[model samples]
Each structure stands twice: as structure tokens, then as C-alpha cells.
Target: MIGLVLAAGAGRRLRPYTDTLPKALVPVDGDTTVLDLTLGNFAEVGLTEVAIVVGYRKEAVYARKEALEAKYGLKITLVDNDKAEEWNNAYSLWCARDVLKRGVILANGDTVHPVSVEKTLLAARGKGQKIILALDTVKNLADEEMKVITQDGKGVQRITKLMDPATATGEYIGVTLIEPEAAEELADALKTTFERDPDLYYEDGYQELVNRGFTVDVEPIGEVTWVEIDNHEDLAKGREIACQY
Candidate 1:
């Protein structure tokens, strides 16, 4: 399996830092960047080949690609997202569908988390599940969180930010395991999702798959520490989480 990262967004909420670099390159623990941690986690989980979807300020990623590869001992492939500044991540993820068919453990580049989360997803991949989402059932979720509602104790029924937090079973952490068999379906779903609305989040793509017959299962990472870096508050939380790791 390959490691995939969607690092395409401009993250305009983060001003000065994002002005020169992509959010993935933002530092949490001094010299260690969000991409650094993500690559390290993926390498720890035995996925040494990683594909990063890059868009706004992609030149920064290109400049540091070699250095990052040498540091993490990971073979990095860059997937360009032309609509990154204009469109959302559904299209960004869809850009990688061609190469990720072997299987993939995808993580959002702006998220800071321990390697244990990657380990959890790798362990759950053994269940022969087609698509598995790493869910944080223990987190205190709000409306901004990408929430998920499951069908009974099994598959994901819905995943979106618009859903009522009260009805959500848990938050879908920015990590997902897509087996080889499900990659094409996911790509198709993403196409449909982007076609419906260019501004849809990638979670909507997962919802499209759920709308079809695909059973996207959830693997709960109970009480684990992680933070998705979006705004200044989230970046602070990410630093805190990274310090623990």
C-alpha cells in the first residue's frame, strides 16, 4: 500500500505562514513540519512510498521534496491539483486515483497525530474491508468537525460537516484506508461529488460511496491525541499534540 496526503489547500486562515508555504510545511514542533510528521508516521507504518497532492504554493513542496525524502527515508511523488485554489479537496483526491489502486492509507497533511493512528489503520486493513475510516469516537465534536453517522455498529451511513453534531456518532479523523478493490469506486464517487458541486469537501466523496452499495467501515481510535491544523487555534492544538508524540 502507498501513503497518500492531501496537502493542496491554501489554508488562507493562516496568513503569514501560508503566504509563503503550503499548510503542510507549517511547523508545529520547532523544525518539524506537519508534512514531516505525516511522512514519518507513514514510514513508521511501513508505507515508504508516499504521494502528496500539491496545489497552492506547490513550488515550496517541490523545492523541499528532495530534502524531505532524504530525511524521512520515503520516496515521494507529487500529484498536481490544478483547481486547488479554486476548488475543494474532492478533486485533489481524485487526481491521485490512478496510482493509489494498490491500496492507500491517506492522511490529511495538516493533521498532527501520533504514529499509533497510522498503526491502527494498518491493523484494521487486515479485516479485508474495502474502505475504512479512522474515527475519533471519544473526541468532543462540534459542527465544524467532519462528523460521521454509522449504520448500527457497522458501516458509515453519512459523513458531512452539515450534519447535526448531536446526531453524529463520531468525528472522521483525516485518515482513511482504501483497499485496491475500492479505489476505482472511490475515484468515481469523487468525480460525481465534484461534478455536483466544485466546492464540496472530500468527505462528500465518501458520502457518495456510502450512497452507493459500498460499505465504508469505521475503525475507532479511542482516546488518541490528534489535531487538524486549520486556523491559529488548531495550529496551537497541533503543537500541543505533537509535543506529546
Candidate 2:
């Protein structure tokens, strides 16, 4: 399976640090940047082939990729999305059309997780499901987190990025595994939505698939730590989590 790391965001929320550098290149601990930690996680998971989608300061991300490959003999492909400023993560995925196929694992570059993510991807492979989303039942979910509404504990009823915390049932932690058929379904869903409305967000595409009776299993990732770094607070938390690893 191929791994796709979405690192193309402008990261406007990350201010000064992102003003001159990509969010993925921002240093977290001493020598390692947030992107290094992310790629390290993939390496631990035995994922040798990786495709990174870069946009803002694309050169920096690509430079890091080159350094990592030279240092560790790692294999990472860079997919540049020139239109990243015009769209969202969905567009990044679209840029990776050649790589995102059956048994593909797409991860966010801003998050650092333990090595078990590879196991999560493998577990979701034979379930015969279209989409498998990693869910973590944690107490720190905010309104901005992706929330999942599941039915019968196996199928996702809905996925909402904006919702009242009190009404949120669970969190959809950004990691996802999709079968080949599901990728086609997702592509079709995205195309249909874009044809109808150009400004539709990517989650709407997944929601469309869910509405079509496609099975979206919420695979629980218990005790396996993952950190999402969007701001200073997240950076602190990510550092703390990395210390444990």
C-alpha cells in the first residue's frame, strides 16, 4: 500500500513561523521538525513508499523529503498542488490521483502518531468496507474536530467538522484507509459534487458516499497516541507526546 501525506496547506493559522516556511518544516523538538516526526511514524509502520502533497513553500517540503531520503535512504515522492490556495485537502488528494488507489493510507502532515497506524491500515483492508476512519474516544475534542455519527457500531451515519461538543458522539481522527472501489466511489462523489457546486468542501464528498449506503467503519484506536498540531497549544502537546515515544 502507498502512503499519501497531505502537507499542502498554507497554514495561515500558524502565523510567523509559516510566513517563510511550510508548516511541515516547523521545528517541534530539538532537531526534528513536525514533518520528520510524521514521516518517522510512517517509517516505523514499514511504509517505504510515500507521496507527499506540497503547496505552500513547496520547495522546503521537497528539500526536506530529499534530505530524509538521502539520510535514511527512504523513498518519498513529492506531488505539488499549484492550486492548493484555491481549494482544500480534497484537492490535494486529487493531485495524487495516480497513487491513491486500493488499500491507500492518507495521513495529515500536521499530526504525529505512534507506529500502530500501519496496523490500523492493515486491519481495515480485509473488512470489505469502502471507507474506514480512525476514531479516538478522547475527552479533549473541540468543536473544530471531525465528529463521527455511527450506527450499529459499524457504519458511519455522518461525519461533521462543525458541531456542538455536547452533541458530538465521537471524533474522526484524520487517518483513513480506503479500498480501490471506495477510491473510485470517492472520486465519483467528489466529481459530482464539484460539478454541482464548485465550493463544496471535501468532507461533503465522504458524506455523499455515506449517504449512498457505503459502509464507513469507525475503527477505534485506543491508547495509541496521535497529536494534531494546528497552533501553539498543539505544538506543546505534540512535544509532550513525542517525549513518551
Write model 2 residue lDDT over 13-73, tens digit each, in one string. Answer: 7788889777777777777776777677667777777888899889887666678876545
Residues forming the 10-long window of minimal summed lDDT in candidate 2: 193-202
TM-score of each: 0.98, 0.90
Which sections of candidate 1 miss by over 4 Å?
none
Provide the overall lDDT of each model, using Cα atoms, as 2-decimal numbers: 0.90, 0.74
lDDT of 1: 0.90
**Residue-wise lDDT of candidate 1 within 1-245, one digit each (tens)?**
98999999999998889999899999999988899998998888777799999999999999999999999899999999999999999999999998669789899988888898888887886766898899999988887899999986569998999988989999998999888999889999999999999999889999899888788999999889888889999999988888777
Model 1: how far is 70 from its true place, Å? 0.8
RMSD of each: 1.0, 2.1
Best by lDDT: 1
